[model samples]
Target: MSENITLTVNGEPREVEQGTTGTDLFGGDKAVLVMRIDGELRDLFREIPDGASVEPVTAQDPEGLAVLRHSAAHVLAQAVQQINPSAKLGIGPPVTDGFYYDFDVAEAFTPDDLKKLEKAMQRIVNEGQTFNRRVITDAEGLEELAHEPYKCELIGLKGNAANAAEGAEAEVGGGELTIYDNVRRDGTVAWGDLCRGPHVPSTKVLGNAFKLMRSAAAYWRGSEKNPQLQRIYGTAWPTKDELKAYLERLAEAEKRDHRKLGAELDLFSFPENIGPGLPVFHPKGGIIKREMEDYVRRRHIEEGFSYVGTPHIAKEDLFYTSGHLPYYADGMFPPLDVDGQNYRLKAMNCPMHNEIFRSRGRSYRELPLRFFEFGTVYRDEKSGVLSGLTRVRMITQDDSHSYVTPEQAPGEIKHLLDFILGLLRDFGMNDFYLELSTRDVDGDKKDKFIGTDEQWDIATKVLSDVALESGLELVPDPGGAAFYGPKISVQARDAIGRTWQMSTIQYDFNQPARFGLEYQAADGSRQQPVMVHSAKFGSIERFLGVLVEHYAGAFPAWLAPVQVLAVPVAEEYYDYLQDVAMKLREAGVRVEVDMSDDRFPKKIRNASKSKAPFILIAGEEDRDNGAVSFRFRDGSQKNGVPVADAIAEITRVITERQNTDPTAG
Candidate 1:
């Protein structure tokens, strides 16, 4: 008689035969792509351990989706090998919304090649080939992957995968070496790769809901010094409808890309003369930026924050004191030697803000002291990573710091969270979730962080508690905290459903001690104040980029660079429109008048292209009637409105700072 093993299946105790596998429990459910036993993802064919907790991972789950994508990547690799037998493989990992596989091939993949690869992958997906995992020793792996140099290198760097390359984890991230083989119905090996995988049971599980997006050149292990391989990008979904929807969202996102919109709207540009990641805002973009700055500054003051200023450069020792020099040196530019002193461009404002806090002694009455600034900082961002405004070297942060006693930490964090959310909502970003980034106490790089374990635990709990109480979806990000302490980052979804990390509030107990910042308590005892770092707009440039994409470059009336553009019915009505524009200008509207040689229709078209919230059109009838016609951004028109009413309506929208469409009924 076979012995029965006790297992906790989905929180319920169950008895199964000793040799029972996950397939025995969940094979009937096609949605169950993989299983998690003892909190680690495993193949369905793997036997369940006695007394272990088990849960089915379906295609709809995040981990299940990653497994599906990884399986699709394997199919893609198989298809590539079928096409070009000489192609060597690199690591294939599932990333956000997709997976990518690197290949060392003779030539760069072209559009036609991608099409061919897709067809091949579909055939492989239809073949119903089973994925079989086998454990192997280092020598065995080296021998089996002798033809693939990258795989051998990964095997050699098994424990230290981080030093190898970016996606190397997918290949050698496990405790032991293993290879996944694509086996045919007859039990013959079709293809194989060195991997640490919990792939879908079979290639057929991928179905036709996978696509080969494109191919690009990527360095091996993400190092420029290494050989460049052609990386094929792809996405996988549980259903065809989901795949279609994802593609549609991608199309819409491309249309709303900030870089493209910035160029077409004449908002901002990255001039080659100024170098990469440095953007110059045009007059239109400047207007939006100035408005943002003014509004945020006013809100900070209203929220009991004192506006402060800091220099662009500081001595190197200050960063060392702040513990940013060694940990954050990669993101900072090289230091400048000024009269035998090393002066470095500031990558953050917290160290300088710490100086201000330590500049004076404080009492417990000023418990939650807050300081805010619009500090422009520079980073040494890699050229490859630089995007239009979102990933720039020059970042203007609405940075703030709150100094409070340990007892006031939670409340202060709650206040900062509320302020951050409110500011985001005011800017038309209402959809949000929170992420709690905590220290990696068990990680290999634990020395990189500073603080006692007790301090870290208290700080993390304070942030986590506040985030959970806010009733928003909170995601845990272990090993993603700053060197000093944990943080709560606000991830906001834009119009197209793409999430961006907008604002953050970090709880730091180490910095105050490092800076020797103290406040006198009521008991006449001095205590180190806890520093909470908050950035309402993580960076002005990045926030503007997000807003540009969020609004699709058609900003609301209040944010529109040219709030009102006056177009003449003809060159004769130019004076009538100019008079109306002057009235609007006097009313504090950013108004412009079309007094060019262009035809009336051309002028109206130009106004429409400008994305002006309101357009005032004057003709002979309007000039004689002491009225002007209103043309809105949606192409709707209201004719014969009194000049006074037009000015009042526009002023009202701007004064109220309405973010909705002004023309909406």
Candidate 2:
């Protein structure tokens, strides 16, 4: 029986028969399809359920393909258990690029073993086996899994994984649990796993558009304390072309990796001896950071922020007053004892900035007193999760705080939104989206919050309204708010379609009240002032890291460590090239002359490898002509241009922030 149901297909309304699967909407074309009901992903066979909204998705939408890949993971898990009966099933979940499944096995699964598993998965998908879901009483499940120790452990957890087990952790807490059993056409159950599923209907939905990527050891549940499990990684698509594209994108991203570029370009380093997560900025690295920080400093001053400095190690009382010690102590470096008093490397700038406000008796005129600082902080991160500059222990945050009267808070917030976004754009980043996070009102730790309900309601509204009225698209992130306040976060999308959080403006009431901060009002009443903590470059170190990945280390001439490098054809031309460097320096450009005894071609290659935006080649004839030949990083050259003309063009490009040389060959 067909009933009338309407759906918005790719932004246009279309009528369809009831009970129509998402695959039916695609008309059997086998394109990667993302489907959602009322803006949320629903499996293809998701019931129409009486006029529910549905939207078809394409492989172009990354999430759509992820759902397809996640479904493929279940197929792989079922195939593995089918081939190796003793291989205990674990958890497999979709990740950023694809999915990985963990298993408790007696021996490592080699590359050869992965090929065998891939073949088995292919056979299952080719067979068109259906995935069936079963829900049973918790007690019944305990009996069914009694023989499987790992499943027994999960059953004991009620599925709250405490110890990391195969593919997941085993903890105790939560709701009734369920298992998904993959069944053959004959209704025989071939394999099953404890799971929370929204899987595609059958293995055929995975098609032949998937491949096993790699095999690695994963802690049973991503916890270091848990038993290790062999995890097989894989990617899947609704079509072959999409799968191929995804693999190519993965390769491109790898090639543009910041760690690799940093070493090759001689920009930064993190020596193992210097310690994990503590990055060292080389001379070139220092230049990049200096430019970034100097730019930020100018913006802060222009925005009416008064610069301030604070000691890196502060008395533990500071954090205790800020209420960070007992609750957030885990993420911070351990405290150090100093002069019979305990101290700690600052993990936050709010506490110190609070003391600065208390330095004088503030007045209503100074109600919105803004203090700014570039404070370095430290944290002790878990070793297993550490990665390049992305997840570092030491970072210098470009932080600021504005104390404002309740009535002035809104304007302050609006100014912050515009200013932060503007600064990010100037750094050659244009794509931006915002997320406004607020407190978990229904959480158990609700009492951990400090502000009165009225203050909370006002602050949250001001932030949300500012984000909305600023003409920027913003999404509300429930329960994503800081423990002490609500926040607005701005993220920039990189060239490879990845997003990075670059700026944040959080409205905090907890810190002000915790430190007993207040100002004398117009009526002579000592009233608590609200605090707006914001950072355009969340951390200078982290911002540089994001910019590195954004431009793939090919920074614009304005921000490049060495914007111009001169290659002298002979030692006799060195004096002329050195003069050229001086000219560029006088023109406010970072330039260098290659004076080493290396060959000219070798010097040019070294400059290009360092991502220099322009290369100046000085030869005898060119030097004699009071000119120099120019080569650009983007493969263009200008022959025998006068030194004055070259300087004028290069300086114009640098001043205008033009990434490509227009006058080059």
Candidate 3:
């Protein structure tokens, strides 16, 4: 039990303590580029076990790749300090798809400066400087960091963080603090950063597969009160091919940015005078919104859901009964005095729905009541956090609350999950993932939740069992649940690999008790019904924004605001084409006849740019022949199809709501 450790790394023998660091012996040498300890990632400063075999982690391993990127960020920070010595460094963490470092600089960095910084980063990596760790006392740490204001701030923050770790009532805790020193071979310090040590052995391990992305102004600690810091973004990967692919995808994602596409397509806008985070959808965008809602309503009705409507605002007493005052009141729009009493623009539709259920005493036969509503709610999202239609203050949720008995909750939950899967499929989202969010066991690590242990256990089990039985790959997210309940979040992957959460099925035992909702069972006793709150497309506006990005503004036939554009080859064919357009309009196709005096090609180009799924080219010859030239957006052309056949085909595509096949690309 007390033996020292001896391990072999890359065929080299090294003797160390019971906890031997993989980075210490093999980390300094040139044999291993990356390291792995006990099958998990440990920074070079981590201690290892006695007689345990240590293997070198390489760039090929997925876990090791982030360290490479983190090291690249350090090199980039060094380059920034070289140019601007006063630039104070902040923490840089490895993020998905890339890494970013914050800097308090004298001036903003431009595109030209990014190029120079990238060049300097390459030079540092080429130098192959050694990375070592240094241990110092708390007082010594403050002295070493005296020159850097931000570093001093970080040291101050550490004290606060440690106090938090101890608990609300402070208890004594002890641990040694350390820093990483990036020293050169000639005994000159290249760079020294106060970080928990875990880095590549030397700068040579980094490759040229890195890029410096755009610079953005970010507030310190995400709070506007702190000074604005310039953050330089960058991406790194193990291979040149992966890096190139990432850059290409980034370019494509930018092209499909929903805010940009919203204006270009005349879909939606936000007025500055209307205050921030509130979107006003134009008439054109309203068409798509209504279509999406109608689709959901029809499906829910078929699944035995009863449509319901509620008021936009409610009395403050209603919220108190539903227990929204302390936990969720912050996100709500401010209360206003109505007739000497307070009222709030409802932030969640569930409370109102609860009032409806309580108005009537329910029998056991009335169990599993599903109520559906497209309720609009208001929130007070600060201006700086708002972005396009994705983050809006005034939005509507496709919200539904289902009340089911404890015994029937599992089956009802499964049915709802299956229903959501079908709806997503219809909307062209096939790839999905599920996350089961639960309360953290170690609440002392942070703020523990306030629910009773028995309530927490029951709610967690309910959602967890449903998620397992649904046959979805379940990922447990610690400390991610709503304050009152646990939820199973349904996320979808877009055309790109990024995942977004679009639906959530939450179980709330607390809310039912808060409102004292009950049903008379067959035994003639009142019992609490387990409440299930579910939303398929979480919000209409947010879902539409996601659709815009997923389809890249190329909506399918059924959802296109203007599905068909009938362009006459010349003015000569206008009357005949106008007649044809009316027939198609009667057939329920969104058709518009081109009346502009512009040339036919220009009109066709405009229609294509509008992203209409169908373009009917009606010329004099085709009008006489009772035929039409059909052109598709994807560069496919069909010549001289009978007008009737073209109409039938277009209707079929619209009625079926076909999506692009993944195999096609």
Most lDDT-accurate candidate: 1
Q: Cα deviation in Å at residue 329, candidate 2? A: 1.4
lDDT of 3 by residue, 213-276 (tens): 8899987667678889898999888767889998899889998899998898899988889878
Query: Which residue pairs does candidate 1 place in steric collision?
Result: 165-221
How close to the true structure is residue 352 of candidate 2, measured as C-alpha lDDT? 94
Cα distance off (Å), candidate 3, residue 355: 0.4
lDDT (0 to 1) per candidate: 0.92, 0.80, 0.80
Every model's TM-score = 0.96, 0.89, 0.92
For residues 336-377, write the lDDT of model 2, one tens digit per residue: 888789999988898999999998899999768999999998
Comparing 1 and 3 by lDDT, which wins? 1
Candidate 3, residue 485: the lDDT equals 76
lDDT of 1 by residue, 1-665 (tens): 99999999999999999989999999999889999999999999999988999999998899899999988888999999999999999989999899999999999999999999999998878889999999999999999889999899999999988887777788889598899999988999999988899889988888889899999999998888989999999999999989999999999999899999999999999999989999999999999999999999999999989999999999999999999989999999999999999999999999999999889889999979999999999999998999889999999999999999889989999999999999998999999999999888788768878888998999999999999999999999988899999999999999888999999999998878889999999999999899999999999999999999999898988999989888888888877888888888888899988888999888889888888888889898999999998988778899999999989988999888878786543
Least well predicted 10-residue stretch by lDDT in candidate 3: 164-173
Q: Worst lDDT window (10 residues) for model 2? A: 164-173
- The per-residue C-alpha lDDT of model 2 at residue 204 equals 78
* Count of clashes in candidate 1: 1
